[model samples]
Target: MMQLDDETLNAYLDGELDPVVRADVEAALARDAEARARLEALRRVSLLGRTAVDELSRLSVDESLQERVWPLPKPEPDCPAARTGRAMTILSGALVLLLGMGLGAWLFPSSPRLAGEAAAVATAWPRQAAWFHHLAAERRTHARPLVLDVEGSEPARLQVELNRTLQQRVVVPDLSDLGLRPLGARLLVEQARPLAQIFYQDAGGNLVSLLVALDSGPDTRPRFERVDDGPATAQWRRANTRYVLVGEPERVRLQDLVPVVAERTTR
Candidate 1:
């Protein structure tokens, strides 16, 4: 009898298995309660991911922020008036720049102030990781499901590829003991840094993600937080590398797994 592994069940659910194998799997599922449960778990996870993506798609951008990023164009006046307006605009912009520079210099005379601003931006990784976690879930539900850059079946290759891409040695911890199997991984660019996202799913079909990126900010221990009511995330920095673990709060207590993941990833 052919063993019903996750790969086989997943392929069967995806309609990717050959007819002969599909028939065999179906026949097995009829009598195998465990196999049936696994199949249902996969289906449930997929549905939840799609629902999350749909909710995200329906969200509206803040009107005030939208206007600031893309201001409406004013109606053009006569050529003479337009030229005059353009000159005035340039003159006003220069004045504002000068005034802003003067104020900044007065408020913060040291270069450390500028460095502090950059550090503030670096601290936004938690929110960024949460957003990308949703994005990955969305991609998974598409008709053509997202193809991982590195398949999870080969842990060695996944680690090698991620290390090479990130230019740093990193560990991909085995979460199977925690009932979460590695699904795959993808490389992403966030905040001008290379980010590696490793995807995982539990037996119940709950999705979990781990994101790794190079950090220039100070090191810190795991801090658990939620992002805009989406997923709960645990963020921490080890040395110069930042790690984020994202998952559905209702389904998983991401905080509990944070230290376990953190300890394993520390090399």
Candidate 2:
């Protein structure tokens, strides 16, 4: 077994290592309790940093900093540069948005109290969704065989298959306007909860993913947030499930699609 230092472990946790090194680190983590514990400690710190970033975003909405953190701007009727810039920004940010944690939910448990649980869910779900998205995208990009018992453009067909396997109603969003068509779904377990990852592809050939999981906590009002998971991800919660949309790195574009996705899936 290769021994990993704190710096290597931290880099592994933050997804700073290259793919080959990362795979080795993962293998090490699986066999090392001490490494896992250290990784968990690092995770707590990362979560704290995310919380601080969230709070800072809330506070800086009226300050100059807001423009830098979130540079979303509406385009004038004739100005194409704003729209082009927005697209470029989202794509560029996607590299930074990649979620660093691997098998996040499976590795990290939620807090016990409702508040703590909710906060944990809030902080973790988006990243988890992002991580799933990256996996799905890689499969698509590499032309890897996706083991789907039911695969098609029809949402109903996919839903029936999902229902049969998951024993839960899976909502399929109509994202045709966004040029994404439903391809299929696969079942997964994360943090001991059922997850339905629905795959789609746009006319432009970009892979899009919608991840649905039962709302484990109270029925809080729907909330939206942008998270970095190697790509720009838009996540929102509905009455019964959490929906995360992962696509090419365009934060503004992702945000614009969130409402359409949220409305369709819930309905």
Candidate 3:
């Protein structure tokens, strides 16, 4: 019989080995006190990780708790799973927004809270609503899309319902290779003008809203500001369109995605 090396034993513990190897390791563990202790330790770590994750999931409900970390509607207090999920939402979200702009959220003492809060509240809204408003306003004013299709495209106008309008907005990366999909085209408008917004989502359920506004550019670039104590936001202007992305206070993923939004708007 082959001696069970520590390396092979560890691989077996982590479930990285083949079934026969795992069986061998298990058999050895059953016979050896030392191996049994080592296996127990690994099991303990795995259990600890799962427990920590579960605990965090329980604490982050949208209810009016001591610190309502989340801005969305609250789940019933009786629903443990929803509570767990929402808590994870807030925890993960906080990690993202907080970490994303550490200097901005933590370092900036003046308006960090407001900037973060506003963006977070608006993050869930659909990009299509932003786009449709632009198109709809144009129809109402000049009666067309680009002053050509008077009466506006009824087919296109039918989109952007209140529910759709209320969907979460997000800033996404251009990961076309991963089979990621854009939210497609949606009309956007600000101040009664036409615009377009593209959206995308990732495996983690984070949504991004991107709009190509036809509205006049703000005289200045979008700045980081807090809104009602939610997430810190990065709002800026690229020539004509406005860029606003909001999320939890600390997120490396969102930070990495910001530049892609800028490039998309510019292009």
Candidate 4:
């Protein structure tokens, strides 16, 4: 029997394993509850890490601070080589500064402000949904196989399946007016709570996802936000359900559709 080590399980989750090895891991997972639990824990940790990185990348330094930290070179006569060199220098400096800030945050997480921010992020369902959306979008872009437990195009059927699996009412909002159609959905778990991500695509091939999860938090109206440099997201809680709509930032005006989805789901 193959040992289901962390590295092997991580590789399986990332779709980096060969068919034979993946089969072996799956077999082990089927028989070993401990292995399955370990895999889920790893998945949660990976999701949280990606979310933190996405949040960190969105941090912006003040323009004055950036200028003071890496003062631009004095302008010289127009030359391709000079321009390229200057651009490279600025890019490299920016990357270094970003990396340094990330390191500082990781090392000194005990800062009151930083700790509070971290706690808020950990509890934010919208951000978690955005992170999952980013992963799915990335895989779709790269033509990788999406690991969906339930796959289909019918909204009603998908809704029924999701609700059954989650043991909770799930609303699959129709966006036909917006030229989007249902593709499928996948189930996810966060802190043992179930989540469903319903996939949709527009006529132009733009992908969107609506993530539904049971919310114990207070009911709130839809609020729009961008997930770092990734998708545009609109999140809201209605009664006991939380919904997050995520789509391509350039192609989707998530705020406009928030009302449409909210009304339909609420009804």
Candidate 5:
């Protein structure tokens, strides 16, 4: 009776769920053979990857060194010229690494061009869903205070497929922190319209697909639908943007995450 939903299951996996929910899920997994098997498989893969990384790290060190954890001894300073050059090389490498990390962090967050594209979609997000469709866009980020808040689709991952699906990359990797994974992504382009789509799912495999299509017409009609025939529900808003989420029956649960996501995204 206490089946874990996608959000809760993902939280459990990520060690973020509360004690009550965690205990409930634990009991449910104990009784649900299929769920237990899946969890075991996930854990095995995760542990195997970590073990391999540890082995590689060990291999990086010299095998003959007895004091692997600390310096055993330093050779005499007979080779001053070589030592100075080595010090300079080490310093240069460290500087380069620090610079690379900083640059990577900046570049990883919403690229500037992507921000403009997302903004166009944000304008329409408010009009898509009946719930919170009334929420207006506002300045949120430190750099772009003009960022608007709109509820449409869950922000997840973007898959850029070149040659119509031959190559791809996961654009939004941060959703892993939110107990979600990338389902799929695509860009919607038309003679008069341009839009972006990102999809996400939790551990229980419930998916939310977001469609951000540019408002081609002067006015666009936003709609919401809960499909009885399918495992998905969709909502759209027509402001200066459009957003949609499609998923299994767990979509009702996903609705609860929207306000939480909106609060964080807008803050």
Candidate 6:
């Protein structure tokens, strides 16, 4: 019998376990309902991530997105556009590096110099997601009503309601299967891109938000990296949609919802 820890279990789910270890995990799952549930959740998250990444790989780089994130100065006839363009390109690259480092610092406040792989994962969007989550959480905390339910209770109903409000097809995950209930839906915008955020509360009164957006890039998916910044966020992508699960860092409970999200947001 192999004792399962977070690392081992994640490795098993990711198919990184060797034959003997994999068999041990399977045996453990045969007798442990909790282990089985966790395994299912990891599978869902992994599949959703891979799907998003594969789809993104097939598409070309979005020029509009490039302009939005890294704007280049306009060319002038009097000056050499090529020279200016090259200089601007170098400047833009430096900006991206500085931005990543800034985000890394914000994410790992105690350890600003994130090393190797973690440094690579420290990018712009997670920082933005964490910041947005912090703002929203603070607002909810200070408000008289800690949580509010503005519309439907179920996923389908909520999706319809949110679509009406957003004027777009917003996929709402049915988290009832995981003992989570929808509190309501809200809209937030970033860089003129509207995002649909669905709120859920567990029996323990823990709040989690699913922030969904229709914009993504080629490098977008198949990864559920945890952000330990202001909020413990589990981020992944599906096609053009990017989803972030925002929860309190103290809670550290959003990972369990990854599978539920992966399954329910298939549409």
Best by lDDT: 1
lDDT of 6 by residue, 205-239 (tens): 67777777765443233233345445656667666
Which candidate, 3 or 6, has the higher lDDT? 6
Each model's lDDT: 0.75, 0.63, 0.47, 0.73, 0.44, 0.63
Q: What pairs collide in candidate 2?
A: 90-249, 90-250, 91-249, 97-228, 97-229, 97-230, 98-229, 98-230, 99-229
Clashes of 6: 1
List pairs with backbone clashes in candidate 5.
123-240, 123-241, 124-241, 127-237, 128-236, 128-237, 137-148, 137-149, 139-145
On the 0 to 100 scale, the lDDT of residue 134 in model 1 is: 77
Model 5, residue 183: C-alpha shift (Å): 4.1
Q: Rank the candidates by lDDT, best first.
A: 1, 4, 2, 6, 3, 5
In candidate 1 the C-alpha lDDT for residue 215 amounts to 72
Which 10-residue span in candidate 1 carries the lowest summed lDDT?
Answer: 114-123
Give a tens-digit lDDT track for model 5, residues 1-267: 887565566678779988987898999988888887777766677799887975564443463463454222332232669668867975774466457556553343233332222232222232232111111111111121221222124442222331122222213334566676654445434333444455555776444555444332233222234332333333433333334544443334544444343333223
**Candidate with better TM-score, 5 vs 6:** 6
lDDT of 2 by residue, 159-207 (tens): 7876665566656777777777777887777656777888777777677
Candidate 6 lands at a TM-score of 0.48
In the range 191-223, model 4's lDDT, one tens digit per residue, is: 677888988888988888888887664677665
Candidate 6 has an lDDT of 0.63
What's each prediction's clash count?
0, 9, 48, 0, 9, 1
The candidate, 1 or 5, that scores higher on lDDT is 1
lDDT of 5 at 104: 58
lDDT per residue as tens, model 3, 1-267: 546676776687677999887787778777788767777787788899988986675443443552244233321343668668867986786677677767566444225353445443442222223323233333434432222211112323323431144232222235555333444445434335454444444455344444444333333334444344433345556554455554334432345555566665455
Most accurate candidate by TM-score: 1
> Total clashes, candidate 4?
0
TM-score of 5: 0.30
- What would the TM-scores of all predictions be? 0.53, 0.48, 0.33, 0.53, 0.30, 0.48
